[model samples]
Target: MAHASTAAAEDSCPLLLGKNKLPRHREADTSEGRVVERIADFQGPGGIIDLVYSAVFTRGIEKVKQECLLEAGELPLVPRNFDCWLCSTELLSLLMRGSALGNVGAHTAEGSPNTTWDGHNTIGLLSKSEKDKGVPIADALKNPLTPVWILHGGDHFTVAWCSAATPAEPGSKFLLHHWNGLPPGGPRLADLEITAIKGAISHGTSPSKFYKPEPGEIEEVVQADPDDKTDFPGQYRKWRYEVMLAFDRPDLQGEQRPVDALPEPKFQQEDPRYQRPGAWRCCLCYDRRFKTMDFSLVPADSPDWCQKCSRSRKECGWSLWIPFAELPPKRQAWCMSQYAKKIEPLLWTKWPEAEILEVSGRELPDC
Candidate 1:
């Protein structure tokens, strides 16, 4: 069963089949649409994004936000971004207006109920007993957006349709494992997205048509950002959650919201009031050393100052990544003391030259 227009309805768009046919449940019965029936197979480093790599939409949703592609988010495709100040709707306002990452405190507040940060639905991939609050599963799949919800489970990802599509297989709401970024059924939602973009371009559709951009248009569109509203990656650091799972749990939010998590806590901020000894030290540097940032995403060569957040270790409270292996022996010892219980063992067990960071993050999803 199928309903609603293709997110990008025209056959020129990749969301549709060869003849502009929507991905109806019956299509899975054929050879062409069977790709949607496969599963994602991911393993090891770089997470799901690594396993399902594609150059078209490189950098995952990040590139999409930083560039233009008006048709990127149409009927079946849900269009939204948190840094609207950077890019509004379909325009490519990628110029770093200010700090690369700096924004109001409640950024993650932009999290939506039924959709993942990238517009995926978790229904079929979630456990029956899972208590995570979100839009109803069955309805999420049959959205005004894409009929297919390229969902992400903990370890792996799945490309699934609504109940009307077919059997979810016993003991689960999805079908088999992901196909390792293969044709038809892709390994990650990003892969599927890029595939669609490629299909659209192959038809000779002008690239500029989809990601149209106009000078000064971004500032005009995002001018009236309401203080209380949010978009993708809202309150991300505050909530200590992944972008995919970050916003769906708005009810979990409370008074802990930082009155102003931005402005980089400069020497002028009241919260980080000037003090003799404290004022001289860089809190951002201290935090990165103590593992304040999400180490999983942090780069070994991360700079002392963050271009996104527009802050440096000089701030009262900020963080970044560490090249633990590259740090001087004394510096390495200090960082180890912070996450001692987790990585200290590496000093003893692993090879002296091993890339110890391989252990900090999540395990690969089993197929």
Candidate 2:
């Protein structure tokens, strides 16, 4: 993986590898509007990056509902009762519409229609013919100018965009972005490419439909055991579909820039405990170790008192009264070293380029 701070780290596996180095810190661009505000930074209170998915999913659902209302004059309320899962078709449709409305940005080829169904193509069931037919889509994605949205039938979505071709590898500059974390192998763009081609070769223009859950299946879906290891009650099992959305036009209105300049994550700045620039741990409780310490920053003039240690002093008979700023440099270093050791596995597993000391503990000297 490139680094955790550069792009949203949705899952444990690394997603994209850009040709250009991503900036370590960036300020939020407030002028671009709320969409930018909503997802420009990667904060981790929830441990999952779902803002992009939530935004796209909600917009797709609303678009479907609006189209239904317009065509039928009365919307069927029954379908809304179940949790909605968007098929590749619906997501592509929403992306196209969002681009047109200037809410989403995409690349498009010159002379291509202002809008075209060509933005989306689905490969069904990884058949031989399907693979052959998907060759063009796969080829188009190789160009850095092309941006495509990939949807996996197994309840996942991700995007791929090309980075500026480098001198070393000019022809293949694809980079992927996924909101959800990836499995062990990292972003599977190559796997998707192979699957797309196989699916196209096998299915060859056959009539197909993205699966939709029935209203009756909603209860079972809601009540299903998350750990059951089986497909959810209404989930589709046999078929896998991949949708590709092309970014042909350079004039599209959206956040088309590379994700280098996102604002600092909120957790680093706002988390009351464990302020940035330092790594801390509860000194009183021998067993209380912190990979990243959890404690609020007190003003420089505030009295030195370890509230956490004080709260349980009767039980542990220890009081860690040293404030963060007053800690001896040697002690501060010790804390940071401990934090680095604790986070070593994560760095090796998910964030290889992580500045271990900067991310895990503190970087500043005690006042």
Candidate 3:
């Protein structure tokens, strides 16, 4: 990632690596509006760097949500139930509507002096945007003009994070679980929205942030119980159990116990190998010992995402994921049935659209 101050502190572009080194798609190669563009110099919080890094590198939403609280201490806010980051919306769009990055790499002038990666196909996404929604108001195939948009950008990639729990229904298993009252159809472009964000740097990724892994290191780094889900970062699992316990004891909108009073996690894992930058593994998919890969080092076009997650149209992202695909068919159905249970109250108060998942949570007070 480039200097946060340089990218977000000011409006001027901070030409990154291939900013000027690569040739711009000649004006002769494009039309107007087809090369749609929106730029913002964010000035909100400084925690966005880590946030975007996680999403672009394909970190699952569950882990991103955990990091929001544990890492940033709620600085970025855990993207309320329905909302999501502008960067996530952008990357999701690229994955869903835009041409695959592999099909969109740049063409060098024969052997124009270049290093490893020159044709910059990166994208700069503000964390917040009021005007970014649209199934696909625009895409790269139509707009090949500038390699980098504005100065805000990150290594372009995709991600998904899903989970499931035991079903509540007696039968009717073997089907995927979807949000209650969720449209049987796909999400419209309008759902993504168009909004402006502050306190975010568009260029939020760098090569140094990624580290290549040694052979067999991937499997060794991923520790599975081969039973229940893997444990959270040391002490976190126990801490989370306590948090839920605290929440359940409180009455509607009542003052809960002080978080500081909560007990520290009883267990912690301290493996130096897994702590390295880009030593990322799919925490959502533990059934199979998937190979771990460095997200930052890989080319923009191809991501080593889990085949199962990819098949589920995971590009929709975490907030937007409707039916949980990570779980087995029967398991996914059971979880959805739970969400469907006792959801009558929320539909009248909230967006109602995204409130289905909350039914599985504590009873929300009517506002």
In lDDT terms, which candidate is top? Answer: 2
Candidate 1 regions with alpha-carbon error over 4 angstroms: 1-139, 142-151, 160-164, 167-367
**Model 2, residue 159: displacement in angstroms?**
4.9
lDDT agreement with native, every candidate: 0.25, 0.27, 0.24
Q: Lowest summed lDDT over 10 consecutive residues: which window, candidate 1? A: 197-206
How high is the lDDT of residue 250 in model 3?
Answer: 25
TM-score of 3: 0.17
Candidate 2 has a TM-score of 0.24
* Residues 2-102, model 2: lDDT tens digits: 11111222111223324243332221222123334544353555313344344345345565556534422333322232365333333333333321122
Q: For residues 56-99, could you state the per-residue lDDT of candidate 3 as single tens digits?
A: 34434554445434311342322334353433333332232221
Segments of candidate 2 deviating more than 4 angstroms: 1-64, 68-88, 92-129, 132-144, 147-180, 184-367
TM-score of each: 0.19, 0.24, 0.17
**Model 3 error, position 25 (Å):** 26
Better of 1 and 3 by lDDT: 1
